[model samples]
Target: MSDARRPNPSNEIMRRKWVRQLRDALLLPPALLYVIIEEIFWNGATALLRQIARTWPVRALQKQLMALPAPVILPLFLVPEILSHIGGFWAAYLVTRGEWAAAMVAGIVIKGSATLMVVWIYQSCERKLLSIRWFAVVHRQALRGRDWVLEKIRPGKELALRLLRRSRAGIIRRFAAIRQVLAARLGFRRRS
Candidate 1:
């Protein structure tokens, strides 16, 4: 005989309490979705987001959502944002007992060091931290832009010309003397 039990037709039933539990359970997973979307949007989805936005569920869903004014739906994002602060608070609670409060107070610390660790965990554990390689790429582009700006603001060529005028002969003399010394040291005599 098969070990698998036959379906219970009676189990098709669901109550208001069950529906409430289902909705509540969904709230937690929305946070997970929030985390995933944020990571992709910031890091990975720049190329694919347009295609995604054009697709059936996202396009249709966004259409419905856009019908509601921004104010009405803005609170949807607030859930995870508040949870982030609450996460910091809980992590602070973990570090501090009654007597430890003095340490936090004496330093006049706005938040304990644990807050930074908590925020980092919030970023990485949620897989929202941008890859370090991508960050370096972005930083390199920013540096290039900055260098371009400095080039635009650079001193006139006349100033550079002035700086080179006296130094040019000195530079040439130094190089020629070094070459002559090397020629002498290497026993290479000039033909008369």
Candidate 2:
């Protein structure tokens, strides 16, 4: 048989090993990611609100945060992030083929990864706001300081965010309302 037609055992083994590695590299623990992402999003959001809080200087961040409910919270943690992993596998496949296809695949992977990264950051804010839990401390702490801390948190925003955590339904309703307002304000030319 021609060499091109012959199967190579070493190549097969290597591909298996690579595939395993890719699966393992999906993402790190949510809690750990939550901590790092939280700090960054909080600080950044604080700065953004400070710039735009002319209406309510003292607690603009708090208020804005509160107005945001959990349903909105769901997509922030979901879509882009989960798609990112899906994108990763697509990326791996891209590497073995056309250069443009690889680039497109890589873009998808990056977008997904970036979204997950944003989720990580938002999660940090969410943890501090809604108080996300860590698996490691499951035996000891259960969503600790979440409600208490938020109740005491500033800007009158906590009430809304607090309420979001209270009822998933409310969150969905509010998120729909907010999204509609946002779409109107932004004047969307296209829908995502």
Candidate 3:
């Protein structure tokens, strides 16, 4: 190759760095979203559902759901997931149309409902659904992806938690001040 045609090490290094930067920038939004969805919505909703599921009526319903066959259980497991995608698409469309408040409300309601249903059904019918080989494979892959994302975002998560912990007292004081101001404006004086 001629001198001009030869690859340059410095240029290659710079290009790689630029590519890395671009890749990280692109990945950050989705990674943060996954973290938020998993940590906030999924965990909280699932925990609440789990408590509800422990009630006698819910337990009876779950027992009936678990008795369902594998084929039936598959669709039951999938419908909520499909609804989730549709809801997400609708929410994105709302955002594109500049309906910010509506989009936020719709996204939360749709996503939260779908998440609760999916978690509830999955927890109830786990064994039956897992009996299907294809589902088991997909479930395993989904779990692996979750683990990978969590691992990738671990540093950011730690940093956020650390900052929140450090700011906890300040945040409480600010909230207290805001409450006092609001209460005074509303003519609700403190008895003490």
Using lDDT, give the best candidate's number.
3
Give every collision pair in model 1: none
- Return whichever of 1 and 3 wins on lDDT: 3
In order, what lDDT does every prediction score?
0.47, 0.53, 0.81
Q: Put the candidates in TM-score order, highest first.
A: 3, 2, 1
**Which runs of model 1 end up more than 4 angstroms from their true locations?**
1-41, 82-192
The model with the greater lDDT, 1 or 2, is 2
TM-score for candidate 1, please give it: 0.23
Residues 76-141 of candidate 1: C-alpha lDDT, one tens digit per residue: 333544554454454346447655655445322333222333333333222222234554475478
Where is model 2 more than 4 Å wrong at Cα? Answer: 1-66, 98-101, 108-124, 128-192
User: What tens-digit string does per-residue lDDT give for candidate 2 at 96-122?
Assistant: 576667757575446445554544435
lDDT of 3 by residue, 1-192 (tens): 899999999999999999988987798677667656656767867866865775699889888888889899888879888877677677778989999888888778887788788889887778888989999999899787677678778998899989998989999899889878866875554567
Which 10-residue window of candidate 3 scores lowest in summed lDDT? 182-191
Q: Is candidate 2 or candidate 3 better by TM-score?
A: 3
